[model samples]
Target: MSAVPILGVIEGFYGRPWTPAQRGRLFARMAAWGMNTFLYAPKDDRWHRQLWRDPYPEAEAEALRGLVEDACQHGLQFVYALAPGLDLDWADDGDRRALAEKFVHVQRLGVEHFSLLFDDIPYAVDRAAQAREQVSATHHVMDTLWPDGQAGLLLLCPTEYCGERAAPSVATSPYLKALGEGLRPGVEILWTGPQVVSTEISVQSVREVNEILRRPVMIWDNLHANDFTLHRVNLGPYAGRPLELRGLVAGLLSNPNNQLELNTPGLFSLTDYASGKSDWTPEASLDRALEVWLPAFNTSSIHRVSLDDLRLVSHLLYLPGGLGPQAVRVLDVARALVNPQTGAEEREALVRELRTVRHRVITVLRALEAGPNRDLLFDLHPYLVDVAEELQRLIVWASHRGEDDPEVFSYRGSLADRLMTLGWKT
Candidate 1:
């Protein structure tokens, strides 16, 4: 009914969930940006996945109640997701009841939106049958908790939730076909484009999945998630999807980076995309995001953080397997610095450029430490440490060594640098 509705965030990453204060800040920001939904589905939240059948402790329940109330206050629809796929017995009536009761408890606490996620678990032996069973389970809960189909925005995240993960393919997967055939008329499916962290989601891919699902799928956007690569955090603008994509999907929700503080740029970028920035480009969104986000980097304006510094940092840590324009330029300079036949004058300039990058890393690190925003500093501390460490290695090579030493190539950080040498297994 709400046109191309449900632009939101799903706290569904596999790491420490955001703290209450952090969530409060997010709710406020989401409202300001006109995002309409918030899904609570953090994978490591034991109660959300591991302890799915158990009731939340009084304190936890009260905390969730307050969260839901606050979200509604800000005009954000709060969705509570139950990830019981880890050990669910589709055949068991007791398990079905447990799932329904779990929803009933939270429904009392004011969670109008609910979803059942059957993702990340082992594939069922009979995929088609399993698909049917999963849909039946969702329907059972719907029938038990809110008969007459009055439940708010219901969703399911199938085990094969993306094109890459689907057995054989999305077009031919019996699992998906069965899932589509069995889905209740109003229930929605959550899909993560082609890959778990797809760099691009084309129109054709969406059309294929939509054809199979028999409905417009809701996007569980993972462009900004960094949980898989702990040393990285993506501050890139949401790119890779066509602007016309909004018309193809039922909704789109970002399952972003675990570090809430680092998500400001990414979430804002998604908001602009979802809320209709008619002429959005990742580069432009990134520039706008940097301007808005740079203020947080400044502690007192004395140890100031310039947009240039943030832009550099973001470009370096832009996205998974992606290099920002500046990052690419820096690498090109580095390559030239190490080239054997490069003239001394040009080599000197290349080395200077690298030294400048390292210098900026130190400056940003110092400014971050000078923060009134310790949380942002804490979240970024690991990456800055890694960057600083690598910058040192790069500078050492560019300034002193023109030759590529085998020893120099093995400068992996953390325990890998110490323990895992060139041929440990061999």
Candidate 2:
């Protein structure tokens, strides 16, 4: 009936350090936007460190109490993350007892939800079984330590791609299924289906896994966090920037999960979702794209480029790979569409020139086939061999000619040159 509740993870597992005041402000902002859950997963914060075990420093404990109190005041649940999965060094009984004490203390502060991270924790050297045991032991500790056997919901971040098989091979599937089944019964599983990036996963695929594990599965679909590196926003290079919000909304509505998160960077991705620009004009969309790109493109040096120039550039290069050579060509065409820089007759001639070049590139790509020439491509292809084959589909899309006498890549390797040549003020 109502929209799904999205959990905005503040002080994520990775990011710039946030002061208490900063965290309080972040929570308040999420609350203002109707967010209901906050997952605190800072790796080396003082509150969750090994030293926190000592007589439970009153001042530090009270500071945490204030965070929890602030969250409740804004109608949000504060999910404290214990480092057992990723921080197994802190999983020893002594450390566990200390953490248990801290958890109990936090309960008194009115915080109930907690998460156990097992995702990025390095595997043990000798036997793989030992790593699984280590994770189980930590869950066992939390199961017993929580007040009344269920102080709050326990969120498990298992080792195998959030409990999905890496390959369909029998050897791997059995191990993943076992890990999923082995998790505590009442605990909620944070499953990030196979890949952490934006992916097309069906509801049926999710239901099958949930049936096998016999537990409620929470989808942690990372539609934006591609490299596992946080802070890079996922707005499209040009016009598609606002369009990305549609993909995010589709993912949210695709599956009605009790929880959803904007896993991109900083604020929300897509200006429409972030700043709420909904006019949908060719000129307006270009301006939004430049607002995102100019800062990222001109990071190293001072550049005097107005937002209008950025808008003009972005409207032309709206391809998925962003403002690459292909996008630049597209921008040139879009500009030519309205008014030709040279002349009316010359504008038609420019389009023909671009089309001829695009035709040649397409022939070159189709010849590559597979196998030997695969290594010629860049991006996640060679690194993640499986996804490389899929990249071939992108070539055709990227090769499409733009309207303005298809802009040429004069300096093949220079990103700056490509931008400057395509009418972008340098």
Candidate 3:
């Protein structure tokens, strides 16, 4: 309902960057979802980060040019970002010139949007002095590349880009204040809310940052990012960001799960929220997303089990307290069946439902093993195997109620240990 906010995706994770083919696919998807921007800032790319002063090799440059053309054809802005803070010599003009030249090279490849990142670098004891130097160095590059403010779009991610890292506090931090005042008016700044992976981003928080920056802050939302832990995959829908947030900033760009397929639901849900869909709820949005997602794994005929259950038992692994509605339903049925007072007919019915759930999970697992999305299967494979084992143990325990079986106890303990490693509650 709110004017569609500037929605975009940033491939800014720390792990292996997405392949060129994968990136092309992402651009097509972003276009379909009405996303307008694509930021190229992968941390592992040496030319983008460590070798920040060097130009891209011809082969790589040609590939990037094709990607930029693809993005433009899809009506997406390809923002080429460079992380020069890792080893940039802020005091050296030659260093500044090299940085400017890199941008110029990218600009020649039809990239008009640019970003300079100074995140994840050591902080100086003289915070204000360092902040001024960083701003000055960035301005020098921007001015050289697009003199007199002719740059199409320029974004900066300051070293103290988030609330926790902003020494003292955002309002009182001399470093941030310097950035706000020293940076040119046309340059946009990127801020990750409160923390790198904030659970919630309130309007008041954005307002405070906006006041200090004297401009609408471009948000780098890490809601679905998983590079911090390989075991985790944040498939949850985009919540905690209110629709009113559209009015508070320049745009919202999410750093999503490393696995491209897993990011679809959250991305779609974000688009819906930004588009003012009044009926939007993370739960409902996830349901609609899975309706399309599950079938891709060739499990469309597996009946009576919902995607919520599938996620809880599988994809939602590696996060604490992550049981989905289906998993909960199975747990409830198991508990009821464990009661000695339960009638035989009711027990049989619960057993049938449990078996159906188990069967569907197996069907999904097999399909994944043989499907094109098998890499995703590999990521979720451990959780799937454990869930299947747990279900079989549960069914066996229920069938022989009140029996003291040492094997059952051993299996239960092993399952508990596995769940704990995956961040699930016992």
Candidate 4:
């Protein structure tokens, strides 16, 4: 296997697409981070998915041409993807021609790589027949465009792309077996491990799919995806998958959070994993990424809050587990405040620490509000504002011997409401 696997970022989330400027910035970042591919498959793009046969307007075509040029200049392969399975008549020759023609139009814009997506659509009654038709149609398109195999990369996302959606089982499913055997060897298939939003991707699982497909798979990782629920955001470092995965697959493309600015740390840590860094750990990688990420706020006050502290808060938001050391310490303070046996000195100490955390959160939030990363602030503003407000209430209660004032009761009610929104325990 090569030392560095083909690392890429797929803008394949179910939300608003990034603007042209955001994409230009993303290409430059991908180049600097040593990523080699960018898959443009935003699910909300009307023409790319719903109206797959329609031609792009003059202005949209110009924008796409410019994006292709930018990607090429950055040494990135811009893979143009179209999801036509929603209403495509795969057996019709006219439908096949339309699919080929749409791709050819993109090819004229200098995009050499292409993908045909059949994911998220309902399965046909005759599964095997559906699979065969999908394979045949894709083969026809590929043969028509690149008879000599000059098309840089032709990728496919089968309808049953993950383990849970695979009927009966992965090894015994007739639809998968047909796809594995019928599709041309030149074409690659995309997989999302055992589940759509997989918490862990093991080598054994990859090997199972690889044996069935007789080829290495390209991972479309949705670990950091937040489209399923708007209230959640994943900011934790990339973990769970072992480093041995570098040799098991063709490439790893992360489907990141909708908020563009918050994805820097996650993508940076993924780059470290792909680069084969022996010393890489998720905690350390997150800290290092934050060093570069926090400075973007252009605020001097942000220097006072440590990256570890920020990670502690973000970890609670994204990952599933008990609180970390910082949260544990804060909880301990809260407990002591409510304990009748606690002394004044202990209460004061706890109050001081809580006040400090509150101040740090305020400083960071203020900087974020005033900074250029408006997207990041928009995603996290509510959470930050709530934390600051809760901290103030906690401070006042701790100072006043857990007084049952209206403000404290109101804070308790608001805390419960916030926790419900995030699906977290109050």
Candidate 5:
């Protein structure tokens, strides 16, 4: 039940960054929960990525300075990552100097942890050359600033950050091999498992990368991330990682849901998962997290939501590869209800169960609208409403015994529907 060295949250999504207030609250919570890092690299922060060479404006600098101070006060390590990979010319010395200057400016504000991310960049045919340039560029900046090798928590997210994204494969990728040979001693690497949003991170996979990187890899876990599909949120437990994984890697940092309020269950469950639990089950872990999160759903209005309802909602949003227990049960009934071979008695049972699910979903939607925590309500509304609608569709199909009307959009003035059919996505 040992812990990974870098256990914390990462604010690195492709949308509006969390507010300073939200970040402050996160630092406090992480500090109390035995977590120790917070990576600040929101993609929409122009200064952090698109304008990586530019110094922060005085007002923004002051705000970041204060955030760094707050992180220090809470005993959490603050790491700032620059996504200059979008357009950095690694061969140019001036670009290297700009990188140094940006980090130095933040360093003056008492920031020590730093990372240079090369993910999501344009791929070059000669990936090894790209890897070599990135390694050299990072060294140039580090030599200018932390020549003594005291670069606190230095990290590099290679262009081929995961096995799936790796050119060819992890072991054979020239880019990864170049990084293994070239990264300066003590600089840690950030990997996002086999895929960018991995459903699992096996110990053997970590071992393979470790040998290739010539260092123990630190995971940038994105299991709970939902920025790509904003309509869906993952409010489930920290899972698919075994206790043995703690021994295989340098650290783990979760890049969770973009919506700050929706991440409580994930963040809290992750903390509990790492708190030396010998027998870790995602269900028990989430139940513990929901116990802490249920109060936020208790509106001042008499329409209160319960832990069971939250659990049901979590099932609906659940994991990437598999559904939660309750969700599985619901899907089972729906599937059975649709089967022609199902007995009449079994059909009655299935229909009864689905009606119960329909009732809970409707009641939860009503209670969510009466929320005392308006921000939480706002973040969850779309997903909850969508679930309710899907359940209603299932109920209608059941009532009709599977002979449903064809879905049709009249060609008269419904231009959007016609336009949608013009694309390959349809």
Candidate 6:
């Protein structure tokens, strides 16, 4: 059997609503690039409200249907993304029923592909209650909407950040289990594993979720989206280059939010890359990763010397020795010292008090490694080699620390200053 076509972004071309002219142009462009699917789910677009309950005036509804028809003619499936949880906040039972009615209405529009987007809903809510309610409502509505029970494809976005939020590593929530039970057999789950923007997926976890949910898992990768604290690390091409997110999956979806400012050529090239038509090499993908990660590294670049530059010194010392529990703690301290948060400053008093302590510790280690101290050096050399390997990783990660927190710059700057004073080389 052939692989399912990769889905590309359908939201915000040029960072704004696609005027009719723009939509037509984009539709043709997408089809030409071998992209077969476009997810039409815009967060801020009120016009999409027409897809539910005929909210749009007659003329507008006709216009939307026309767009759908055009998409079908071009051999592309336009997936309607219904913001059930985000837009239709079901604070009460009535709101839930109303949402169901809207789903029924949209089903009448001959729209085959549908997505129940529960993403971005507050996780603090009674998740179990929300899941059951959504499942029951969806099942009930789709029953009435498609009496024959032959609904086309259904996509469900569970209440977590699929590819952007990478915590709660395990997807064994009770709410999710309940959702699986309530889901109609034909429903396809858009499973967002706990690893947001994760290049390496835990296949065991993937298998576990599939077995539990009893649905084919389609990975929703946010390759083009850049969310640092929440979802840092861009996974897609940045400069009209291809960033192949290689993975063993049933299908791939590029969930680009409103951030991508892709030009026509860039868009087409990305579409080709996603569709697996273009030659996407691993080297090319790594190059794209570097482009996205390099800027962050620049913010936290460290000079060779400046042991007084606490963070860099700690990085240099800690990495080569291996990342022990104490090592991690010291590095954290160095990081905090260099770019002390307001609260950190109030507690540490500019980290001056700890300078002597840090220097003493390094001096002792160096003494242990002295040439005449053969036994100590012999024991420490192996450990130092191990530490060096880990330190290299730390350096690479520190170089990009600014991607998540720009404040890491303060540490980089102070480290550079200390290095210059100490006459250290890069």
Q: lDDT tens digits, residues 1-426, model 3?
A: 435456889999999999887888788878887899989899998999988889999999998899899989989998999999988887787887898888889989989899999999999998999889988977887787777665588889999998999989999999889899898888889999988987778899999998988899998988788899765676667777776777888988988888876777778777766775656676776666566566656643433335655565444342222545555677788778777788989988887887777777776677677776666677667656766766666666666643545143544556646555352212
Error of 3 at 368 (Å): 2.9
Distance from true location, Cα of 232 in model 4, Å: 2.1
lDDT of 5: 0.84
> TM-scores across all candidates?
0.93, 0.54, 0.83, 0.87, 0.91, 0.55
Indicate the worst ten consecutive residues by lDDT in candidate 4.
Answer: 417-426
Question: What TM-score number comes out for model 4?
Answer: 0.87
> Runs in model 1 with CA error above 4 Å?
1-3, 401-413, 418-426
Note each model's CA RMSD in angstroms.
Answer: 3.4, 13.5, 4.6, 3.7, 3.7, 16.2
Off by over 4 Å in 4: 301-305, 320-352, 372-375, 390-426
Q: Give model 3 RMSD, 1 decimal.
A: 4.6
Ranking by lDDT: 1, 5, 4, 3, 6, 2
User: What digit string (tens of lDDT, one per residue) describes model 5 on residues 128-211?
Assistant: 999898899878767866888665888889999998998789989899999999998778999999999999999999999999
Question: Residue 247 of candidate 1: its Cα lDDT?
Answer: 93
How many residue pairs collide in each prediction?
Answer: 0, 5, 2, 0, 0, 11
Candidate 6: lDDT over CA atoms? 0.50
Q: Candidate 5 regions off by >4 Å?
A: 340-349, 400-426
lDDT of 6 by residue, 27-131 (tens): 776676566776776655564443343355667667767877888887878777676564555567766677666665555565677777766666645666777
Q: Kindly list the per-residue Cα lDDT of model 2 for residues 1-426, writing each as its tens digit.
A: 113334454353343345577567657656654556776655556555333454447886787788888888888788876554445444367766665666666667666887665666565543246435745655765765563576666666565544343335323455446656576676666665534543444455555556655654665544433234321223232122233333232112111111112111213222223334455543444344345434432322323334443343322222223443444764465456435245757655655644543443333233332323232222112222211221222222233433323344333467743553454221
- The better-scoring model by TM-score among 1 and 6 is 1
Candidate 6 C-alpha error for residue 58, in Å: 3.3
Candidates 2 and 4 compared: the better one by lDDT is 4
Best by lDDT: 1
In model 4, the Cα lDDT at residue 372 comes to: 68
